[model samples]
Target: MGTALEDSEIYQKFARITDSLLSPEIEDFKDSGGKVVGFFCSTVPEELFTAAGMLPFRMRGTGSTSTELADTCFTPINCTFPRHCFNQALEYEFEFLDALIVINSCDHIRRIYDNWIDQLDEPEMIHVMSLPRKTGDRQVDWYREEIAELKGKLEEHFGIEITDDAISDAIKLHNDVRRLQRELYELRKVDRPPITGAEVLRVMVAGTALPKADYREMLQELIGTVRGLEGNGDHKARVLVTGSQLDDPEFIELIEGQGALVVTDATCFGTRLMWRRIDEDEPDPIRAMAQYYVHDRPSCPRMHGDQPRRLDFLKELVEEFKVDGVIGERMNFCDIWQVEHFMTGGDLKEEGISFTQVDREYILAGKGQLQTRVQAFVETMKGTD
Candidate 1:
């Protein structure tokens, strides 16, 4: 039954986009004189770019085969995610972007801004935001100022104005995207989900690649299509995945291939991107966006003093989705997520939730080992049941 949904035309369209760095929609958008601003972290607001009449692209290393070229610039011990992304840039995979935006989410990601400025010739405009490590009123205010600064840069560089009304409209448009995504996630709460985790990831990653309006329409059609199909109940265990910046559906597919249904996740590219909405009625849309993005959404490890809140959020998802186990997968050398995964494994175990931790490369390299670990974990869950 899940296969029926995965085989649909719309689902295939999403998969095609997720499978590559450049998509046809992006090419068409470029052809139509639309500018694209590529960003690294989820903390960077996409609405600001939309308000500026430019597409906000979430950068990823989807088709990267190796970090060979990037290794010359980055150390061997750096997190592979950013290394692969920089490799993609070096290979000219991201030449379509008119500008690039980065945030100080972590040391590994923050380095991209320095290296990009020194190395890249394309993406004429490169900017980075200094995000606060703690959440507070002052921090939110600071972030709002940062957003305003970026907005001003866009307006000045592109010879356009990101008016308050345009920002408000962009907020409303993105809120619709969030609402539709929440609707799709609601379907995953069932005993048997019509859509697989890999398929859902494909859809989510597609959102980062396509224009918000086009992605919203495709999501609407997809949610309607999925609702009509029967659910797939063939998996042995219900699992929730959490950890480092995951953008590849193949990693999720590897876990699901081991007879576990990845019902939900707390990863950057997954629920974290769509879980919260910006207040549409706030007279100051930038402040509203700052409040929502900085304080309201789920906190990743980069945000200090939020570990308890993150664990609580994961536990809530476990209860709601009836998750049998949690898999904490992090990229090697990601100090923040490494600490988070350690604490999460111990904390979730204290609550009697089964937890397994995996260390993976930026690209999917150790397939046999990952498959073995996942298979053993699923078997253990089955036995406990």
Candidate 2:
């Protein structure tokens, strides 16, 4: 398992950005290419970037703040990811970046684009996009428009034109990935998912970091070897997880280890990005993309706080995924999720969803603590079965 931690120590250190740290990777990329764009989302449309031949990298926000670096550029009220990254960028930590793209996937992202555009002077092209949250024709049309608008932006900003063939080729690569991931998810539906939650997280993160073609192949190989029998678990428990900014996989591994699979989840890094992408032939990508945000299984703390909507989404997940219980994974210091954790936890209790809460951290070395929590939850969920 080439976990995220498998990388060099320097890379891991770089991943944790407080508002104070200067970002060398961000800066160096700028220096190398002179100008490149950043995509801040769980998913960026690979087709557009690949066709354009421009350097595109995913912005993985740690959601931690460095008060010294970020204080002047972002309001304290903003999300940590926005405050920290924007703070560093304003100080020229990302001077090499000529532009950035933000999709309307969450409140923090919307705020990030608005504040960033307002701060940067001429020559900075900030493209704010609307992402369609659901699947089908309405979605296809919206994503099509999004692709076109993005194409136009590339033309205007990079002085490079994106052709229809490029769009088609990009879509094909992404679609192949989509198909394989869907198959892999189906394999996970079994009693024993071959790849661990940590592994799954790695694959998903690579979805952002690696090229689409490589990621799909890696997943296909990893998912093929079913982990065989689960060493833990009471043999039964439906599990549901709710959280925000969940790019890490330690917690997911814990719950899965305990004898239950994470059939359903509500997190910023999961389905919110997983289910969304732009295809080649969608006529109106922007409209399709915009509606995806409103119509999909809305994520907590980000969407409207209507208690019923929260419960409905949870209940539906439980039923569809056949979950036995629910787990809310909060990071040790994630303020946004800390609040949502309570709201979602309370409503879940009211609706009679068996559940537990764990405050997890991002440090990759502590696998033992994670395994313990997961074992206990699985045992609890099994409940004398």
- TM of each candidate vs. truth: 0.98, 0.66
lDDT of each: 0.91, 0.58
RMSD of every candidate to native, in Å, equals 1.2, 6.6
Runs in model 1 with CA error above 4 Å?
none
lDDT of 2 by residue, 252-330 (tens): 6556566566665766555545544443455543333334434443544544344466667777767766677788877
Q: What is candidate 1's lDDT per residue for 261-368, written digit by digit as tens? A: 999999988889988889887899999989888888888889989999999999999999999999998999888988998898999999999999988998898899
lDDT of 2: 0.58
